[model samples]
Each structure stands twice: as structure tokens, then as C-alpha cells.
Target: MARKPDTDKRIAVLGLGRFGGSLALELMRQRWEVIGVDANPAVVQGYADQLTHAAVANTTEETALRQLGITDLTHAVVGIGTDLEAGILTTSLLADLGVANIWAKAVSRQHARILERVGAHNVVLPEHEMGERVAHLVTGHILNFIEFEDDYALVKTRAPAEATDRTLADSELRTRYGVTVVSIKRPGENFTYATAGTTLYAGDILIVAGRTRDVEAFASLG
Candidate 1:
């Protein structure tokens, strides 16, 4: 895993809308030093004293951002839900100022593509990703799965009918399922693959890791 900086964890959030406000609150709750910015004075005042620093400024202007001293920060999140042009400009300014990580929330796929093009490290589509995960689980037997990275995932699925009544070694599931059998959760036991030689009774949930499509296909086999 890429380690975040060991120095002071400083985060700057632009736009004091609900998404930005909530993120600021959560970061403050974790004891992170946060600087929050918004174009509306009232919105900035709403989070006064809750965040490390709150200011009213238009982030689209490079001069205003420089004056706000936000360029010194190492991390920033652009949470503007509307006026994507402002978000893209602010993201570009942050990147120019050498912010190591910039997380920009996009309202649509086109917006996300533009943000990424503007040097944003990550473009977050919270609703889209959540919907995809929910739809996947609703349509398949996967209890839960987490996307670890672009090409990797961790998934937990109910043992398939064919997977029941067989030992892990007997199943050759790695070859068959094309997923690494990380572990198994029997009704009351957690078994690692090293010890998967034991019997797998029905209803045992198998925790596996692989590509998203592979994991989903294996999960649907139940």
C-alpha cells in the first residue's frame, strides 16, 4: 500500500456543500488538520471552529488561492457538486501548487474524464460506484466485496452447490475458479487456504480474491 505522508496530515476541502462539509467534519473527527473553503461566507461560518481553519474565497482564482495559503498544503479535495468548470480550475491550481493528492468529486462520467485530464489524482463518483456495488450484490450471491485496486478485489461468497461436500484441496478451486482462495469461513471457524484441506460442508462462505468479473462470475455459480 502507498503510505501517506508521515508529516502533519493537512487537508484542504473546497466548496462547503453537504459533501464537502461532511468530509470536513469526518476528517476533523479523526483529528486531521483541515482547511475548508467556500464562496459563501455563511457556509464558511457554518463550520467555523469545527475545522482547523475556514475561509470564504473563490478557488477558481489562482491569486485568491495563493492568498489563502492553501498552496502550502500537501492534500486537497474538490467537493464542488455543481459548476464543474470551477472544480476543474481549482484542481488544476492545486496540482500546479504541488499538492500531492487531489480528490475531485465528479457529477458524471464526462466530468470525471475532464477532472482526470486536469491532473486530478482521483475522480470520485460516489453514487455511481455505490450503485454498481449494490447492483452487483443484488444480482448475484456475493455477500460483500471490496475493490482493492484497479485490477484486484476481495470478495466473500456463499459456497456453491458443487463446492459443498468437498475438501478445499479436492475442489482445486484456484484452478477452477481462477481466484486465489484467501480464506474460508465455516459456520464458526476461519480457515486459511493453508489448512483448507479439511472438509467444506454446505453453506460455508469462501473469501476469495481476483479480478472483479472473475469474482462476480465465481460468486454467481451458487
Candidate 2:
């Protein structure tokens, strides 16, 4: 589905690292007016023509952020990947500026907790999230996986022959593996939510969700 345009949102992305740069561009592509910032002049210059606005400033400093009018932004992203202290400082400053939403990237659990305590509305651990998905893929059973929150995941796995010709209730999934079969995707068709009576078939893909451990166990079965 095409996402609704975010034309009304004035966004600021501090940190022009790989993730931050890409995120700012994507938001602009979705029609959001974005200010891309980075302490490195080279990075800022590279995106100058591509973004609505791009600047080189020390996002950790209050004065620099104020000068750029970042405090007036409705949303901001502190994507400092290597500088943890700067990331924390930027997040706190954004909160002080009363930005409605502040998102930051954290390298570790401790960093994530600090970001939250410092007033970040959301903290992301991209490495951990992507690593989990890649690990599942290497297992060769999981077709796709997404982590909505820590310790839980939504996974798509191929339906084995034995699992076919049976209703979801007969699968004993929740009772045995603690996963709920949420939907089924037949090849070349849209997703269909799985009901208790929904029959599974070979070659059908199942979307299941639950504790990560349980999801892993269930995927291992196929």
C-alpha cells in the first residue's frame, strides 16, 4: 500500500551516517520537509541538493540546533552511530526543545535505556534487529521475519507437507510451541488472516507471532 504523504511534518535528522542519511532521504521521498544535519561537512554537502535542507552542525550543542531551527521541528532523529555521548546529548536537547517525537539509535542495552531516560520517544537497535532476521534466514526454514519489540517476532515459514490438510486448531501450535498462526500467504496472492478453521496447505506460507524462542522452535519444525 502507498503510504500517506507526510507533508505537514517538519522533520530533522541529526547524524548523516549511513542509516540517518538514508532515513532522511526516504522521509523526503514520502513528502516530508526534512532538515538533514551532520557534524561532518562532507556528509552534509553530499545531501545538500537532494534534501529540502542540509546543514553541517554539531547536533550535540544547543546553540547549533537552535540556529538551524531544529527545535521547531515536529519530529527528529538522532542517528549518531559511533558517538554515544553526542547521541544522548542530542536526544536530551530535542526533548528540551519540546519536539513531539524524538527517535535515537542505540548500540547496546545500556545505551537504549539511557536514550529513553533522556526523553527519547523511541530507541532503535538496528544491528540487533537485522542480525536476528539474518540468523533466521540462514536457518533455511524462515522465509521472512520482523521484530516489532524485543523478545517477540513475526515470522513467515513454509508449511511442511504434514502441516498441510489441517486446520489451525489441529496444528497444536499454541499448545506445543506457543506461537499463533496469524495468516497464510498463497503464492501470487495477498495475505489472508488465519482463523482457527483456516486450512493449511503445502507450499502455503504461514505468518506466526510469539516469543522469539517459541517462534524459532516452530520455524525449526519446518
Best by lDDT: 2
List model 1 lDDT by residue over 1-222, tens digit each: 242352568889998898899999999999989999999999999899799999999999989888877777778999998888899999887877777888999989999999999878988887887887788778768888788668778788888888778877888877887876677777877665635676666878878888887888888987
lDDT of 2 by residue, 121-188 (tens): 89999898788789889989898988776788889998767678998889777897899999999889
For model 1, the stretches where C-alpha displacement exceeds 4 angstroms are 1-6, 148-152, 188-199
Highest-scoring model, TM-score: 2
Cα error, candidate 2, residue 161 (Å) = 3.0
Question: Worst ten-residue run, lDDT, model 2?
Answer: 1-10
Q: What ranges in model 2 sit over 4 Å off?
A: 1-8
Write down the lDDT that model 1 would get.
0.84
The per-model lDDT (C-alpha) reads: 0.84, 0.87
RMSD to the hidden true structure, all candidates: 3.6, 4.5
Q: Point out the worst 10-residue segment of candidate 1 by lDDT.
A: 1-10
